[model samples]
Target: MLSYSEQEILAANVNPATGLATDYLNLFNEAIMLFEMGLDMPDMAEELADWHPRGYIEHFEKSGFELKDVVIAAYEHAPADIRGEFDAACERALTMFDTSIRVLMTANLEDPAAHADLSDRLRDMKGLVVEMDSHIHGRSPAQKSLQSEVDALF
Candidate 1:
């Protein structure tokens, strides 16, 4: 089940010639959805396992829009009750995006140290996203203060 925002992004990303969402944002959206689904339902782990980190990094590089700005806009437009959750999710997503960029930038995937770093970052991102998903599924008082801080950042 894609979120409203994700659906909207996919819809907007459709290529007229292909009549399909083969654009960068759509790929990024799909990757994020896979991440969320994998977290909520372990049964989808096999599908999620096939996700490539470069797809999102390529989206970020090509979009010419900062992920934070997109997130802030999403938070601002979301309903009050869910704004906090959206904010937390956005923050985590941005971190994950940054980590993805690092992983892509590393030229030596065969190197033990580089591989370990990528693994650590991926694990950390998964944990952060899991926490974000919890907030998305349920309301939390802590999100209010965190949202306020996020507001101050922009």
Candidate 2:
């Protein structure tokens, strides 16, 4: 059985050869912690309103996880529609992660085939990041233009 730290260290390494950046690892750690908390809270609906990573929180909540402070922070930071999207994505990603973890746990990496399967399973997580990036970057162009205008005004 993998210790929690071992699991975290393994999970944090998105790309070993390229070496995952600290920011990405931090984001992953934050995402995992918030995911677990979101799974245990009682007033999930209310809490979700303020989650910082609102998207991921909402996603997990929909996947049957409980909501906690992360939900509240999300609502505090995101607009209504974006919050909804975040929640949905969080739910989807959490579901995928849960299944992926189970699959990884069942595999015996001593077998080369099992190791390859584990690798494939991890690569699948990149989709979650991709989905998040799409949402996070979708508004960048407009935000940049607005930022430039504000900078000029100042």
Show where candidate 2 strays beyond 4 Å: 1-77, 137-154
Show where candidate 1 strays beyond 4 Å: 1-82, 139-154
Tell me the deviation in Å of residue 10 in model 2: 31
TM-score of each: 0.39, 0.41
Candidate 2 per-residue C-alpha lDDT over 40-134 given as tens digits, one digit per residue, 9 for 90 to 100: 33233233333333233343344332322333333344455654564465567666665655544454546778666655644554445554433
lDDT of 2: 0.41
- State candidate 2's TM-score: 0.41
**Residue-level lDDT tens digits of model 1 in 45-129:** 3464455444323444555553433333343454555555545555656658555544435325556676566556555654454
Worst-scoring 10-residue span by lDDT in model 1: 14-23
Q: After superposition, how far is residue 55 of candidate 2 from its true place, in Å?
A: 8.4
